[model samples]
Target: MTDLARVRAAAERLQGHVRRTPLLSSPFLDEIAGRRVLVKAECLQHTGSFKFRGAWAALTALDQGIGSRGVLAYSSGNHAQGVALAARMLGLPAVVVMPADAPRLKIDNTRALGAEVVLYDRATEDRDAIGAALAEARGLTLVPPFDHPEVIAGQGSTGLEIAEQAAERGVTAADVIVCCGGGGFASGIALALEGSGLRVRTAEPAGFDDMARSLASGQVERNAALSGSICDAIVTPQPGKLTLPILQRLAGPGLVVTDDEALRAVALAFQRLKVVAEPGGAVALAAVLFRPAEIKGDTVICTLSGGNVDAEVFQRALQRQAVND
Candidate 1:
C-alpha cells in the first residue's frame, strides 16, 4: 500500500539521489487566476521528468539477483528515460519498448541514457505484449510505467514534500491539480496527502480523459483513441488497477482540457514561469488557468510533471504565443 510511511521511506531512500524540486509561485499567475498558486516543478527533475523517483525506488527495492539480468519497460517517453536512468545508477542494463511515433527527443534521451530502444507500431501492436516477449526472451525483469506498489510509494514522495512545503508556507488546505496518465502520479500523491488537508485533482487531455470518467463512474474506462493529441507522454488508456481505488477515494472529479489549452499552458509556463512543460505536463496548469472558477480552492498547487519535449514541438508551442501577442 502507498501510505505515508511508505512514502516517507521512499523519501528517505531518495534524499541524495533525486533533487527536491522547488515549489514556485508566480505573481503573474496569481493576478490572472485571482488566487494564490504554487507549482511543483518536477519538470526540473533528473531525466527531465518525475518518473525517475518511482523508477529509482522500485529498481533499488528489488533483489540483487533480479537486477543482474537487467530490466525491461514499455513507455512512450518519460518512464522509459526514468527506468533507463535508474538501471544505469544501479549498474544494470535496460531495454525500453516505445511507440514508433513517440517524440524524437524522448526516444533519443532514452538511448543516450544507455538503454537499448525497441520501437513498436502503436497503431498496430500491443506494447505490453512486446515488452513481455522481450523480457521473457532476454530474462529481464519488467518494470511497468505504473501499477506497481514500490513505484506508487516512490511517487507518493512528491506529495509528502508538497504537504510539508505547503505547511511551511502557512497553507493549511489547498487543491492540488496533477497531470494524470495511468494514475500513478495522481493516486500516489493522493494517498500521501490523505490526512494533510490537501485534495488531489487530475487534469488530462479531453478525448483521453479516462481517469475522469472512471472517477465519476466508479469503474475503469478506456480512451476511444490514444492518438490525435500532442500529449504523447500521457495517452494511457485507463486508470491503473492499483491506482484507481486511491484516486476514487481521494481525488476530485478529474478535469479535461483541450490540446490547444495544453499548448497555451506550455507557452505560458515559458513566458511567465520560465519553465519547460510538455503538453502532458501542462494539462494541470491548463485546467487551473482556463477554468479557474471551476477549481474549488483559494490556494492551489499544480504539478508540472515533465519537460522532455522535442525542440521543434517546443518551438511551435512558443511561436503560437508570439503569434497571439
Candidate 2:
C-alpha cells in the first residue's frame, strides 16, 4: 500500500510536471443523483489521463544515469502515452510495447511524443514478456504500469488533489468513485484518503470486474475474459499483486457497470457536463447515477480517467441516447 506521506512527497515532486485538474460540478447531475457530484476532470490532464503522474514519478525515482539509457513499459494505451510523454520531458528515450488493439489515438499520440512503439497482439503475446526482453536488450529501465511503489504513490496525487479541492469547497467527506483496472487508481486514492473521512470505491465494466469479485472474496481473482468489453482501458486480466492488498484494506465492494450503462454515462456527461468521457473513463459516473446504493456519502467525487475515445465511438453513444429518448 502507498502511504499518505509518500503521496505527499509525490505531490511535491509533481509540482510543475503535472496539472492540477479542476473539480467540476453539475447541478443537473446533482438533482438527479440526489447528491453533489464532483468530477475530477483528469481527461484534461497532460497526455489526457492521470497516468502521466505515475509515469513521471517512476521515471524520476530511478538513478540519473538510467534516463540516458531510456525506459520501457507495456500499456494498453494511457500509460504508454503517459510514459512516452514523461520520457520526452525528462530527455530520456522511451519504448512502449502496446497491444495491437489499443485505441488508435493513444498509439498515435505516444509516437507523436517521440517514443518508439512496439505493437503486439494482446491475446497471443505476453506484453510483460516482450517489454522485459526489449528492456534488457536495449538497456532501458522497466516501468510497470501499476505495481511499483512510486507509481502507486504518484497516482495517489489524484486523490490528494481531490481532498484539497473538495476541502476548499467546504466538502470534508465524499464517496470517491474511481474507474479501476488493476486497482492502482482506487487503491492509491483509498490510501491517500485514509483518516480523511472519505471512502473510496472502484467501478469496473460488468464482466471484467475482477477487483470487485476479489474484494468480495477476500482474495485476488482474475477475469474470465478481457477482450469482449467495450471498456478497453479498464479490462485487465486481474488486479496487481501490490495494489490488491491496499484495496482489500481500504476500498469498499467493487461496483460493476455494464457496457451500455457506461455508454449512457458517456453521453450524459457530454450533454450535462460537456466533457468527452470515454466508456471506461465514465464508469464511476455510471455507478453514481445508476447504482447509488453503493455510494455512502451525500457528496460524490468521480475520476473521469481519460477522454481518449475514438470519434466514431463517441458519435454512436450520442446516437443511442437519441433513439432511447
Candidate 3:
C-alpha cells in the first residue's frame, strides 16, 4: 500500500502547480442512483488530463544531478502529452515514445509541447525497449507511464483534492470511482482515501477489462486479443505490477460497462453538466449511474480523468445519443 504521508507530501509539493479541480454535484446522477454523486472535473486539469499530476511529481522528485538529465517515456496518448508539458514547465528536455496508432491530435499536441515524439508499432515493436535504448544513449531518466512510486504518489494528489473538497462541503464517506487502465489513477486515489472514511472502486470497458479479470482470478491476466473500444485510454492488456497490490487492498470489485454505455455517458456529461468528457473519463460516471450495487456510499466521487477525445469521436457520441433518443 502507498503511504498516505508521502502522498500528502506530494500534495504539498504540488500546491500551486496542479489544478484543484472542482467537485461537482450531479442532480441527474443523484436521481438515477438515488444518492448524491460528485464528479471531480480533472478533464479541466493541465494537459486536459489528470496524468499531469504524476508527470509533474515524477519530474520534480528527481535529485538536482538527475534534473540535469533529460526525461524519456513510453505512452499511448495522455501520458505522452502530460510528460511533454511537465518537462517543458520544468525546463527539462523530454522524449516520448508513442504507439503509431495513438490519436493524431494527442500526438500533435505532445510535439507542440516541445517534446520529441518517437512513434512505434504497438503490435510489433516494444516501445519500452526502444525508450530504454534512447534513455541509455542520451543519459536520460526513464519515466515509466504508470509503474513508478513517484508517479503513483503524484497521481494520489487527485484523491487528496477530492477528499479535501468533500470535507469542505460537509460530506463524508464517499465512494470514489475512477477508470482503471494500468491502475495508476485508481491506486493513487485509493491511497489518498486510506484514512478518509471512503471506499474506492475501479471502472473499465467490458471488452478491455483486464483489472476486473485479474481481481477475480487472484492473479494478473493479460488480455491476448485486445479489442478496440471507444474508451481508448483504459485499454491496457494488464495492470501494473506496483499498482495491483495497492488496488487489491483498497478497491472493491471492478465494474465494467459497454462501449455504447461509455459513449452515452460522454454525451450525458455534455448535455447535463455542460462538460465534455472523453469516453475514458466518462466511464466512472457510467459506473455511478449504471452499477449502483458495486458502489457503497450515498455520496460518491467519480474522477473525470481526461477530455482529450477528437472532434469526430465526440460528434459520433453525440450522434449515437441523438439516435437513441
* TM-score of each prediction: 0.95, 0.95, 0.95
For residue 68, model 1's alpha carbon misses the true position, in angstroms, by 1.8
Worst 10 residues of 1 by lDDT: 1-10
Q: Is candidate 2 or candidate 3 better by TM-score?
A: 2
Q: On a 0 to 100 scale, what is the lDDT of residue 134 in model 3?
A: 89
lDDT of 2: 0.88
lDDT of 3 by residue, 232-314 (tens): 88788899999998988888888899888889888888987788899988999988877788777678788889998889999
Each candidate's lDDT (Cα)? 0.89, 0.88, 0.86
Error of 2 at 24 (Å): 0.7
| Poorly placed runs, candidate 1 (over 4 Å) | 100-104, 120-126
Give the per-residue lDDT of model 1 (tens digit) for 1-325. Answer: 7777887788788889998998988898887777898999999999988999999888888898888899998875788889999899889989999889977777888899989999999799998889888888888998888899889888888998899889999997999999999999998899889987899999999999999999999888999996788998899888899999989889998999999889888999998899999999999998888889879778989999999888888998988878876
- Tell me model 1's lDDT, rounded to 2 decimals: 0.89
Lowest lDDT 10-mer window, candidate 2?
A: 101-110
Ordering by lDDT: 1, 2, 3
lDDT of model 2 at position 114: 89
Q: Residues 59-166, candidate 2, lDDT per residue (tens digit)?
A: 888889876899998875788888999999999999988889877777788899989989998789987789889888989998888888989988999999999999
TM-score of 3: 0.95
